[model samples]
Target chain A: MTNAIETTNLTRRYGKTTALANLNLSVAQGSIYGFIGPNGAGKTTTLRLLAGLLEPSSGEIRLLNQKLSGSGTEAQRLVGYMPDFFGVYDDLRVWEYLDFFARCYGLDHARRRTTVEQLLDLVDLTPRRNDFVQNLSRGMQQRLCLAHALVHDPPILLLDEPASGLDPRARVELRELLRTLREMGKTIVLSSHILSELAEICTEIGIIDCGQMIVSGSVDAVRQQLQGGSHLRIRILGAVEPAVEALQNTPAASRLPAIAEVRVDSSDERVLHVELANATEETQAALLTHLVTSGILVSEYHAQTENLENLFLRLTEVMS
Target chain B: MKNVQFISLQPNPIIIKELRIRMRGIRPYAILTIFLIALVAAGYGMYHLMLRQALFGGSMLSFQVGQGLFSGLALCEICLIVFLAPAMTSGAISSEREQLTYEMLLATPLRPASILWGKLVAALSYIFLLIFAAVPVFSVVLMFGGIAPWDLLKVFLLLLITAITCGTIGLFCSSLLRRTSQATVISYSAILVLIGSTMMAGSLWSYFSGPIWQPVPPELLYLNPFSALISIVTVTPATSTDFFFGGDVFGLPLLSQFAAGVVHYGPNGPVVLPIYRATIVFYLILTVALYWISTHLVLPRRRWIPRWSDVTFAVLLAVLIGGTWLTHDWWRVLPPPSI
Candidate 1:
């Protein structure tokens, strides 16, 4: 599949400090790409660069396969960007705000009217259409800003910390909205310091720290690339001690190259935890068969999926 | 296709948006009402005072009373325009940055020039409305007959030019500075210096050069907007009159030195005083140059000196030098160089 966004050795410097250094990023079309990083990890700088609000000090950027030029209006037309620190014009009514942006995008009057109506509905701000922007709640304003970014119907979206100040419900709404947009074939590059924020919706993820991207790829691919290994949780039907003993002597647990270590979960006596140096479905199945055959109370058998937060920490730590 | 072209030809969105907001508010209308009412009361009050003097002196010329009223009103409007232009414009771009909306604007398809002109025109349009509202009051000069229609037109043009220059300087500050309050302070400070320094320097130069043959120190007064207004009005009656007051005229009175001298001519024969023309052109070119700089600065992403902007600057400098050469004869007639 063609990439929707690509940057090669993109570097942005402020005086002697480099905000983003030799960053190479590739986002596939229609995928929700999550950019995770700590505070001042160059997430906002990268988003700003992609938005064309800041020119890179060096390197190349291609959005939707078109090389960026001076001013980047051509690339800007293809991307909708929502900055981390953004404010609406409090003096303008909700519809007027959207209408102004639509006009800037050169939408005709009739189209603007319809687009504003549809966008308000999409963002669920139809009731606040005539109200001044300042009258909206923080969450409502965030949604309105999201609607404003979508005014031109750009194919690629660059959102920096969109859920930063949002309440849990508002964050969920934003996630749902983004998911809908992704389903509609829009390539989304979302950046957030919150790891859980990117966990559910992102098809691919990148962890950046100290102006460098530590790891980036599909969620599973990144985890596997780091090879931080897998964690399996097995709960016995009766006593955890017998299951733990059986797991120690099992061929799949001892001889299998994938299984690195096996031990009982200390907090819960009935649960046995196994750490695999390398895990594959075949190895997991083999272990499960051996546990049953060895006469361990095969009540629960599961392979835990590595979460983005853990992988992010591992990658950022390794980079540091 | 026609409809699309027409839409594209419409005014900048920033202008439209600002105008719509300003027009909907009570502040602009209230300010307009108060401005006009004050102008009327002040003009009539001056007329009443002039009328009493005329009656007591036994030479009650209606033209004299009208001139007094027009001068009072014109001076008041000039002060108001100077004050209000910066007030309207000093926050034009800075406040957007403060409000955190500047980034969104910078990312849009709108050109930087469009945004700069939009803010300026929006502010000036309000000032124009205030000016137009007083047209009936200014027309009072017509009843008594010392002021010609052209004179009123010149006053209006002066007000506009002053507003444009001051407003552009304010915008330039707004673009360069981060905070609205900071921009406003700098803008007002710049305006005060522009208006005050010229006259102050002229007085000083006149006093210091008293030993030698000193003209009316056109070097210092050339950029003074207040002085420009006076010269425009003073030269109206005798189109061929010398607006530059020559001879050693010192102090504030030197501002009106246009009174006694016969007109002088350059190689091209007699023309309007070059200082007056230079003041107008100076402000006009300065306004345009400041506006271009403001637009350049307001871009969220600006290179220190892009090759294109460098070339544009070169071309502009070339044009300025070439134009100076073309108008060499006209400039030679401006008062002799002084400190």
Candidate 2:
């Protein structure tokens, strides 16, 4: 797949402090890429750089295979940026707000009129078209901001902390809206400190901390790469001590070569949480067969996947 | 193709937006009403005072009454320009920063020059409206027949130029400073220094020149709008046409001693350039330079960094060269009339 946005050694500095340091980023067309990081972790800086709002101290940015110039005016047409913190103009109606931006982009009058209506409708804010921008609720304002970004209909959208200050329902609505945009083939890159917020919607995730990207890939790929291997949960009827002892024995260890470590669940003694070392489905089946032949009553056997929150915490902890 | 480009640039969006916001509310109308009322009251009072003087002196209404009333109204209008012009635009860019809307505007493809131009035009348009609204009061000066329509036009032109220069100064400060209040304070302070220092310098130069009747060089008063106005209204056949600082109405004892013309010896005779013309030229150049600097300051990432002082130095150099070129006849001497 072609990359919608690409950066090589992108860096930004403010006086003696480095906000972003030698970062490489890539987002494929039509994919939702989530940038996960803590506060002051250069998430906003990276977005600003991509949005062409900040000049990079070193390195180059390419959007759709064209290198961005220093002024970023040409690239500005291809990227729609929604800043994390923005203010709406007072005394400006919602449609007028969109129209103003449209005019800024030098859109013709007829196009501006239709574009404003389409954007308001797309953000589901058509009902409040004439309401003053400041009078809208926070969530509605966010959507309006998003709508403003879309006025030019850029193919790539850079949203910084788009879900912050949003209620659950608003967040869900935002997600749906993003999904709709994605279906229309926009490469969406959004940032957040919360991993769960992006985990469900992001096709790909990059965890950045301390001005560096720790790891980036498809969601499952990052999980697998970070956790090293899958985990198995085994529940045997009655005496779980036998299963634990049997799994720990040298003979069983040799037979079940995939088993790395076996521990009984602290709360439920009959359950065993087994860590596997690079175990495939065939190896899991063999291990199950060997356990059953050893006279252990097995009631439930399944793999327990690690959640993204635990992975994020563990990854950041190790980095720090 | 050129026509298309020119057509696209008309009617900047910021001007439209600012005018809508400023005009939609009742505050501008209220301020305009109050401003007009004050001018009328001042005019009425000056007219009555002039009428009583004529009555007491056993004379009919004459040119002196009209001239006095015109000067009073013109001075009042100049004061309004000095105070209101800067206040209108000092908050133009800084308020955007305060409202957090500056970044969004910067992110667009609109050139920085367009933003600056839009802001200046919007601020000065209202000021121009205020100046033109008092035209009827100014027309009352025609009844007594001392000030001509041509003189009235000149006065309005000076007011317009003064407003533009003051507005540009406020905008420059607004772009340089981060907060609106700071911008406003600095803008007013700058105007105070411009007006105050010029008057003081002119008076001091006349004092130390060794003779009471010697003309203080016109360069000192070229940037003072008040002096320019004085020079314009007080012109007569007896006094040199462009002489300023000849009037002693403010009780400055030294002003009465100064000659009525800024005279420079030339091969032929004394040369005089109208102080109002010099003032207009100097201010127009200044407005352009300040507009340039403010545009650079408002940009998110300036392509080139030229210090404000550097621009100021360049402008001063241009003014000096232009001033010398405009008065080049002073450089041609005839060896003391072949003594």
Q: DockQ, in order, for the candidates?
A: 0.38, 0.36
Q: Residue-wise lDDT of candidate 1 within B1-339, one digit each (tens)?
A: 011111365558998899878888788779888988999898777766655655565344677556656766777888898999999999999998998888888777777767878998998899889888889999988898777898788888878888899989899999899999999999999988997777666545545676743545455665677666665555322223322111211112333443221123334443334355556667767876787677678776654546465576657756765676687666434542332
lDDT by residue (tens digit), candidate 2, B88-135: 999999998998888788777777778888989999999898999999
**Interface RMSD values for all candidates:** 4.6, 5.7
Best by TM-score: 1
Residues A16-106, candidate 2: write the lDDT tens digits. 8988889999899999999988888899999888888888999899998989888877556888888888878879999989988887777
Worst 10 residues of 1 chain A by lDDT: A250-259
TM-score of each: 0.88, 0.86
Clashing pairs in 1: none
lDDT per residue as tens, model 1, A1-320: 88999999999999999999999999999999999988899999998888888888999999978998757776558888888999798889999999998888778878789889989998999998999999998989998988888888888888888888888899899999999888878899999877777878899999889999888998778778776678888988887766667666655425353556777777877777798876777777877887788777777888787777777777777777
Once fitted onto the true fold, the runs of candidate 2 whose alpha carbons sit more than 4 angstroms away are: A233-240, A246-272, A285-301, B1-10, B54-60, B202-217, B235-273, B305-324, B327-339
Error of 2 at B228 (Å): 1.4
DockQ of candidate 2 compared with the true complex? 0.36
Q: Residue A257's C-alpha lDDT in candidate 2?
A: 53
